[model samples]
Target: MQSIKNGLVFIAVFIILATSCSKVEDTVIHHPKDPNTTYFPMAIGNYWIYHEFTLEPGGEVPTGKIDSTYIEKDTLINGNLYFVYKSSLSLQWEMIMRDSSSYLVNYLGEIFFHAKSIGDTIFREVNLNPLGDTIFAQYRIMHDGPDQIQLPAGVFSVLDATNVQLFPKAVSGPKERIMNNFYAKDVGLVFRNYFLYGKQHALKLARYHIEK
Candidate 1:
């Protein structure tokens, strides 16, 4: 009887261990595949505050300002759901959608950013002056790998996206425009540099909140 009880106990212990191991294996198998999605997290209540500065033409002296951007709510457009984006700097609201493939798309079907994309990806081309129609711009997004960037919100690994003028050629005087946006995993945008005409506008992350 003593030996039988010991054997039963051993079987019970083995069953418990097997169950635990199975659970661990399941967790590993179900782990998230696209971590890049965290680079541009989209959820209601997620917000970022920026310290904005504008530099004078051909100079590094910057006049500072502050602005914030946040996700207000979710709305359906064309049978697809998108988050409504708002900013303290502008009254205009934008509709943003994210797919499982890590692409951020606007309501107009424009690709804002692709987190997994490499090299140069042309997402938008627009005529700056529609009436003029001759002054055109091309917006490109790319991921040049990862780098460590430091800000008021601490240091984080970030991805980069750049936008530049393709037509009319970029010059030093007027009509020159270039923009760079940096995004951190699970943290959204951390820094931005927008140079237009002869002035430079920069934004650095001041603080942020991500609602999981």
Candidate 2:
């Protein structure tokens, strides 16, 4: 019975995803800064998706929905993106939902970019785990030209998607599934996705967007 319901939920997400608007292209865009320099892509007051992990394994998964919101406050001297946010998980069928309302949270971390000696690889370092108060960080490795950025095709990453990674790994449930849709004027409305299994749940997405 529980499995049936969970499967239905997953199907619903995809159905909505199929019809969601496409990503729009931005002719006026900014390129990434030099690898030697730290770049802050998020601006103060901008809201970004923090993340929601909803994968449950080896048992009946709950019917809780996870959502996130971020407000960029300041960039640290080290070039990390810092922001304030509120996240909520709602178990509509369970009474526990009332006790777990969204709360304000603070995060300070940097997106470290490193240029390797071979193959022109880029490495990103973040604080890592989001649960242990260790600061949240996600990393991505991209293949690039000496002067150009190459990222998986997606609206969320078109501008800065050069090997971008989202942190707080999604292991079991719905969150582990790589399905996304997002829109922005600069990057335009886009569809992006990621999926991971077992250990090394590194996530990546193909860029799809709609632009004028």
Q: Best TM-score goes to which candidate? A: 1
| Residue 143 Cα positional deviation in candidate 1, in Å, after optimal superposition | 2.9
Error of 1 at 165 (Å): 1.5
Predicted candidate 2 versus true structure: per-residue lDDT over 115-189, tens digit per residue: 222133234455635565434343333322223212233212222223333334545343322222222223321
lDDT of 1 by residue, 1-212 (tens): 01111111000000000000011110111112244456777888877776655554444344556656777788887778788777554556454665535777777777766767757684867676646655667667676523555555566566667766545634534453556676776777777766433445566676776786
| Candidate 1 accuracy as TM-score | 0.69
Model 2 bad stretches (over 4 Å)? 1-41, 49-66, 75-119, 124-139, 143-212
RMSD of each: 20.0, 13.9
List residue ranges in candidate 1 displaced over 4 A: 1-36, 55-62, 126-134, 167-176, 196-198
Best model number under lDDT: 1
How displaced is residue 41 in candidate 2, in Å? 4.3
lDDT of 1: 0.57
